[model samples]
Target: MSDSHPKVLLTGATGFVGGRLLPALLEAGLSTRCLVRSAERFRKPGTGGPGFETVEGDLLDPGSLARALEGMDAAFYLVHSMGGRSISRYRDYIDRDIRAAENFVRAADAAGVKRIIYLGGLGETGDNLSDHLSSRQMVGEILQSGRVQTTALRAANIIGAGGAPFEMLRYLVERIPLMVCPRWIDTKCQPIAIQNVIEYLLGCLLQPAAAGLTLDIGGPDIITYRDLMLIYARARGLKRVIVTVPVLTPKLSSYWINLITPVPAGVVMPLVEGLKNEVICKDNRILDLVPIRLIPMEEAVCMALAEISEGPGRIPSMQSCLIRDV
Candidate 1:
């Protein structure tokens, strides 16, 4: 690749956010290389595109990753082990993420990659953090271990199609007329649209200011899960009541989620536990650095609904399943 048009390596191209991001990267006229576990999984027969390549590699395999990272200017680390059956054990989840990140970072460093961009969860910097958030933070730390500059974009609930929180809200609202809400349902969270998130990720790729910084990304509004349910109910023209009970623990909530939604107990438990922490954005440093118009909650919800209604585009069902499990 020419110096003017740097080659970028992207991990998790078959994932939910990565699936949306691939078209955006192509549209931006950047040379892109995606790493997938299976070559067949990354193949798109009819969609002909230039400056796009796919290579079979796993984060666990250092040799394949080193080859994949060769000649790449920048890399995007978008992989997470949220859907894995072993995520129920906090130590296993942390170990997997840390090891994967370490391997990727070492490979990127050896390939002389300029930068690494990571997407992580948003939560307070305290010992009381949920396991999911803790693992995300640890991954960010692991990525920074190498000499390559890393940018960590910590975000709260991302409101879009194929996201866990949004799908959970959709299932809860669509399945039950009345919700027996958990205590965490009232906790505040800042939600950003999938569009805005894509913009932020791409912005970091283009903006020099985003290098080696941990920036918080969120929407213009902050609302509780209950408030979100009410908005969704209003949008769908459904009347529903939420009865909050302090007795419903994360374990109990996971069991209920398994029964009500398509999400499994193993996946839902950690996500439910994470809801205990309020994940609102702490500062707007990213907004000042990489300026992009933020989308409102209602508009974001509408766009997600439209995308869901339109059926699948380039995004795969496996990606959707993985996202819901997250």
Candidate 2:
């Protein structure tokens, strides 16, 4: 690594995507700093390693975020609120997501940071977007408002150990032999693997083309939620059946998911509602810029399973999967 290598500030370092991203950023030889809520969390097994500097901070608090943003060349915004009980009542969700982005942007500007990289969801803009996707888009806008260059990577269902989509698929396939699928099940989605997402994030750090841009990243295969379940079933060596019923609204589907999977009604509702919209990437601009060979869905699923069998904390698994589903 050159002396000119950027010192990167990473938020959400304890979360699923951030946890996976930490190792990748370290391996890439970048000078890395992580913003964590509690320093004690960093002492846990599989949390820290060489090349990481952990600082305590809270996104909800601008002062803390400003302190964390000091002396960094760039920052990654990877936080989201899905575990909350009621998505509708989460004023803090919007406030924290938007305000945190804004504060980070302002702090980065004050610190003379060069760029901001954010990971958001993939969905068509307009009224069709779910609350989660809408908030994610808002975060991107907030970050871009600052003078610093911002790169936003929008992805559809990310398939990996510790990702929400993978955990949902795992639970649904493992728990329910016969799934009563909703209309969203047939909706098309481009699911990217965790490895590919990490690749894209790393690529952004070096690719000038990624600056001040929003890029869509997806896997090589464009498949449906139904297709995802089938692939998982085949991978797990379990024969399962899906019965698509037309009358099941997103609300009812969420209830069903809550019953069958480890995902709560709050998380499942937005995720299910979002599935109603097809999430396939509309452009290949990212390919021209990052030029990564996307992994196939089957291979991604196999890798996730392999990680799961190896043991806990090696891979990020949903709390629900470990406690309720598995």
Query: Best TM-score goes to which candidate?
Result: 1
Error of 2 at 259 (Å): 2.8
**What is the alpha-carbon lDDT for the whole of candidate 2?**
0.79
Record all residue pairs in model 2 with backbone atoms less than 3 Å apart, i.e. clashing: 162-316
* Candidate 2 runs further than 4 Å off: 1-4, 43-50, 86-92, 316-325
Give residue 3's error in model 2 in angstroms: 7.2
Q: Give each model's clash number.
A: 0, 1
TM-scores for every candidate against the unseen true structure: 0.93, 0.92
Task: Report the error of model 2 at residue 5, Å.
Answer: 1.0
Worst 10 residues of 1 by lDDT: 317-326
Query: Least accurate stretch of 10 residues (summed lDDT) in model 2?
Result: 316-325
* TM-score of structure candidate 1: 0.93
